[model samples]
Target chain A: MGTRNKLIYLLAALGGLLVIRNLYVILLQFPDEAAQGAIYRIMFFHVPCWFICFTAFLAAGVASILYLWKRRMVFDNVAVSAVEIGVVFTATGLVTGSIWARVIWGIWWTWDPRLTWAFITLLVYLGYLMLRRAIDDPTERAKNSAVLCIFAFVSVVITYKAIDWWRTQHPGAVLSFRTGGGNIEPAWEMMLLWNFLALGLIAAAVLLIRLNQEQVRREVDGLRRRVHEL
Target chain B: MRFLRQAGTIAVKDLKAELRTKEAINASLSFALVILLLFSFAFDPTAEQTREISGGLLWLVFAFAGALILNRSFSREQANDCLDILVASPVSGAALFIGKAVANAILILAVEVVCLPVFGVFYNITWTKRPWWLLLVLVLATWGLTVIGTMFSALTVNLRLRELMLPVLVYPMMIPSLMAAMQLTTLLIAGEPVTGEDIVWLRLLIGFDIIFTALGIGLVETVLVN
Candidate 1:
């Protein structure tokens, strides 16, 4: 197998191990909370999913800027790949948040600022993918979607601020790293970090796989164009 | 100064072309009126509750109908290769973008001017107290909408599904501006003075306008380059 394939397998294996170990620590080792018990555990996944989502989106936005600045196909590939992963992580974040809400807030959804902005962010990036589909030329697709991707990050920033500004049903920060840790158990904070590391590894592996797929797809498209010219 | 002149000249050129046909204005005005009528039927427009939602209904009409006008901004230049000629001429892409955005803003505002009175009549609301504040909100919000709409118009002008693509992309970005505009309009229409707390929405409107206007001008050259 190639070096790329070896790297993928290695990352996936390491990620799998960390994920199972994190799950063990999360479910078995961790005790039930004083309030909200098991449902609150969803935060382990929920917070990290957003962490992954924002990280991926930040990567995509930076790559898009580089694409525009340098006129590079690799940057375009990175932007598209990162976006696809970002969208999946965003969906995961929303779902995990929703499940937590259903238990705690007594509804499947609410139009609170954080939830509303999350939904809007999802729609905007989905629009980015649709816009990509509507264009045929590769260079035009890269440039237009690059511009759109950069603008789309604005929604992400707004979503982050939504919780901060409104402080609605979504609880304000409790994690021990932000806003002076907000009086949460340090053990829980450690567990959240472990979960984040496990998840980040998995997301990084998926990103690599997607980038490789995008590279292969581009090669095939280039070859097809050559054949057409012949 | 030269840039502003170029932009103004392009804006004038577009306005002249649009004024000649009046197709977009006619369509958007009628569409706005129809939405107002339909909304009145959907909700008892005379109800006390209507005052709470009147701003939302009004801006919804502006946004949707104004989209009709925005869609035509660049596509009209496609006839007889006018877009090519415009790009090939001395006009810069940024000027072409601002020019088209300004013209679209003016056209959309005109439609709003016609719709506001009809909306007032239909919804049984009066704007006697703060018409100037309402107008400021209208101008700021309309500029925000047209800047994003016009930029996306250029982006999607040549696509196979231009009409469908433009709105999907534009509306999400329009949310901040629309929310600010809608809330300010509602407050003003209710005869309430603009308070310190409400000033934030106005700030949001201005910030959104500045951010998007700058982005539109900065990126239009990339979007419009063949």
Candidate 2:
């Protein structure tokens, strides 16, 4: 009945439909790889998860800057929402990747640059959350974490360049926007597209849910304060 | 010009205060010595082994000592509400930040200058043979560390538990500079001739220092305003 609830359901329905379509193409339509075989199938989910992870963190960084500049709580909520979701997607990417590596690279883990960068990024953001929990003052927590997001994101950029700066066996990027999604076969491309659409819808829904939750929690805090005074 | 003069005056003020008390230098040097002693006790690695890891051990000293030193950089201002006095002055936040950063870097550099040869004598590392290259790397890398440490020091000045938060907040940001410095020092310690590889690490160090110094100047005002 409410507008926010309707929006959530609408996004969820759209995501579900797109995901079904993605599975249709993945399991049935797309042809298998001549070299990697069934293991290559995981790339569909792996790439999209990482794509979302990067997008989410970058969004968090921008929101962090805006929060510092504008002194707005909205951006703080946006930042915390984006970073928490980003960490989940990054974990998804890491797990999916490790599985793919187990089947393909003959080991569950490697000190490859991309994997190391992902782990470092995860720790850095995890540190962000830790700092948030450690500080009790709401304003201080928001401001410090905003400055921290900027600092963490810059370090991640340095980590990204580690491949070129040193030697590592981690494969190069998967979705190369420079080459317009490099070398994916037509059917595979279609599956990837639908999967990205599905993940995008899911990200939007999660962000909405988080923002709504924060709003309600703030209201609850305000009501508690009023009750205490009475 | 007036702004820079103010910045210089602040740095001089810190230097004078540090000279009179001699508190920070004593603590930082003692901390560095403890780290050196700890490394030997923990492993007591052979000359060959020490050569391999001396770069890492040296940075551990820098990271920990830098943390100790950075807290003092702002702690002086916290007494008698002197920080409010400075912030309320017409001098820009950038000046306050750079002055503190410079003073912290100089103090830590003095600690490192003494600790470097002490480490050499203790670890039996002959990398001191290339004192020029070693000092270059040390100076650049320590500046990079202090810039971030100094800014974060101001940021955490008002926190209830800053000592706990400072290292957690500062170490990750030090990775690039630390990595590059480690590589360069490793090369020098390995007795490898200076070549294109060392040049790459040097460039990385300079680039990191420049970027962070600019960032500190840009972002420190926000931290100081509160």
Candidate 3:
């Protein structure tokens, strides 16, 4: 394997080990009563997935701004790759959230504000992908989809604030390290930080791989077009 | 001042064309009325539930109608290759955006005025109780919708599935605005006292309008150029 491929494989293996460690802590080591018992184990996967999804979306927004500013196709590819990874993480978050809800709330789904807004976020990005597919011209597609990504970012801000504006059953935020009084114990905090770092690295690795694939596909298409012209 | 003059000319040109054709107004108003009628029948106009849901119903109709109007607002510009002409002109993209937004707001407001009385008749609700407040809410909410709608309409004008794409792009962003408007209107219709919370919602709406208007102004050049 080339040096780059070897490096990626090492990172991928490290990511896998971290995930395995997370499962071990949740299932065998950590006390069941830590988050109200064994039921809370879902947080090990769910919370990190959600955090990674939002981070990916924020990255997509930044990439979109860069694409619009520089008119670079690479930035557009980065934006699309980030969003596609975001969708995967979002789906993972949704399914894990459903399982958590079933165990805790005794139901699979409720119109609870957080759940509803999560669904809305999913739909909005799905619509973004559909909009990209509907347009044929590459430059036009990039411009339109960049605008959409920016708009979706703005909409997320509004949606996040909506629950506070209207009274809803969704619980207020749990962890706020920024405010300096995170209620989590030191051990749990360490585990959480490890999980977050590991998952974030995994998400970045996936985005890079997808971006490379997109570049290769674009190059192949260009070659085909050139051959046709000849 | 120069930009305003150019924008005014563009606005006037769109108004004159719309006046001669009357296509956008007719299609949007008819579609809105049909939605209202369907809601009336589906919800049982005489039920207490209908009274409670009237605010949501009205906003839903307006949202659909607004999308329809927005979709068509730019299609003609694209069809006649007038968008190319507009872009080539010395007018700033921001000015063009304002021109289109103002024209669309006027069209949507006209539809609301016509539909409001029809709604009252069909649903048997009295309209005279809080006319000023209701109108105020309508104007503010519609203003916010039209501004964002016009910007997206311009952005999506070049897309293949313009009709389906506009609403998918717009409605999710408009949810907070629609929710706030619906809640405020519900209070007004029920003769409940408007509280400080209502003002907070109004401020949210205004904030959305300002932020989106600024973003639209900044990015419209990008949209127009490519």
Best by TM-score: 1
Sorted into a CAPRI-style docking class, model 1 comes out as: high
Name the docking class for model 2. Answer: medium
- Pick the winner on TM-score between candidates 1 and 3: 1
lDDT of 2 by residue, A1-230 (tens): 78988998899889988988788878887777899988898989988887788788999999999999998988989998999998999899999989999989999999775677778788888878877877776777789889888888875675556656766677664444534665766667667767878998989899889998978876787898889999
Worst 10 residues of 2 chain A by lDDT: A173-182
DockQ of candidate 1 relative to the true structure: 0.85
Q: What's the i-RMS of each model?
A: 0.7, 1.7, 1.3
Give the winner by TM-score: 2 or 3: 3
Index of the highest-lDDT prediction:
1
Model 2 alpha-carbon miss at residue A99, Å: 2.5
CA shift of A21, model 2, Å: 3.0
Model 1, runs deviating above 4 Å: none
Candidate 1 lDDT over B1-226, as tens digits, reads: 8789999998898899889999999999999888888887797777998888878988999999999999999999898999988888988999889888888999999999999888777777886579899999999999999998999899898899998999999999899899899999999989898898788889889998999898888999888886
**Better model by DockQ, 1 or 2?**
1
Q: Count the backbone clashes (under 3 Å) in each candidate.
A: 0, 0, 1
- Order the candidates by DockQ, highest first — what do you get? 1, 3, 2
| Candidate 3 error regions (>4 Å) | A159-167
Model 2 scores a C-alpha lDDT of: 0.83
Query: What C-alpha lDDT do the candidate models reach, one value each?
Result: 0.89, 0.83, 0.81
Worst 10-residue lDDT window for candidate 3 chain B reads B189-198
Model 2 misplaced regions, further than 4 Å: A28-32, A159-161, A179-182, A225-230
TM-score order, best first, reads: 1, 3, 2
